[model samples]
Target: MISKIYSSSSIYFSTDDKIDFFGPKCTREPSYNYKLSGKQDGDGGFWNTFYELDFYIIHNCTNHGAKMRQIRRNTQYAPASALFVEIKPWNSSITNQGQETAEFF
Candidate 1:
């Protein structure tokens, strides 16, 4: 299936437990517009600029199987940066077959 892309629009994210990609916000989600501001409270973090590069934050709306949408934003957005990615070392002795570290569990 071909999903339409909003290349001219911006993106945002909600870290609040009460918010999501779809739900009450989804209805509020625009069909042809975007919100990209951190000016007002509860506007979600408008970190990334709209349509900057090919960068996008997408999520599958709740109860919408096999469908996904990108997080949208308004005009006043916050500039953000990816600080670092956390990497965890793989423990072969604990996870490998027959290594058997059941006592830790």
Candidate 2:
């Protein structure tokens, strides 16, 4: 048997214990759009960005299962780096296994 470990802040967990990727202040409907930010703008932190990367790999299967729809770079006041990845609506075989082979790039 194999086990995988995911590193993320516990504060991002939902009430049901799932990862709260979008977080409490999420401003979009359910989709691949991601807004990763820290406690303050220009805090020079990459915590949420790391989680976004994790979710990207997990959802896209090593970047082979989805296409990037849009990406917004972060600024000092708007420190959240936003991204929207588009995937097939009916891809029932998406292997959410990239976490098992996690790598930081």
Candidate 3:
């Protein structure tokens, strides 16, 4: 799993000047191969962190093969400082579980 830690000082802004962490355009490319996991961490604790998984498209172009999981931490105390993601599938066989798995930081 790929893990990243963000401090509480980073300034994130949207194209519309709106303040956001994940912003409104955070999503996987459709033409590319990938699948996103669920939102795992939301507890207001020192160990809070966000996690997700991406499954790369295989040679067949119809199935997902290689996969990678990413984890990140909140950089600010904003109420909207939560994890957000979108999953894109190459085909319709892939399904969304809509479940998050949390772990200590």
Best model number under TM-score? 1
lDDT of 1 by residue, 1-105 (tens): 111122223324422211112122233232423322121222224543322222123444334342444432222223233232221222221111121121210
Any residue pairs clashing in model 2, and if so which? none
**Any runs in candidate 2 off by more than 4 Å, and if so which?**
1-31, 40-94, 100-105
Among all candidates shown, the one with the greatest lDDT: 3
TM-scores for all candidates: the values are 0.20, 0.17, 0.18
Off by over 4 Å in 3: 1-48, 61-83, 87-105
Judged by whole-model lDDT over C-alpha atoms, candidate 3 comes out at: 0.29
Note the clash tally of each candidate.
Answer: 9, 0, 1
Task: Residues 1-105, candidate 3: write the lDDT tens digits.
Answer: 222223232224411111222212222444333233333333334543422232321111123432322232222342335555443323432222112233212
Q: Which ten residues in a row have the lowest lDDT in candidate 1?
A: 93-102
**Candidate 1 segments exceeding 4 Å error:** 1-56, 77-105
- Any residue pairs clashing in model 3, and if so which? 8-75
Ranking by TM-score: 1, 3, 2
Better of 2 and 3 by lDDT: 3
Candidate 3 lDDT score at position 3: 22
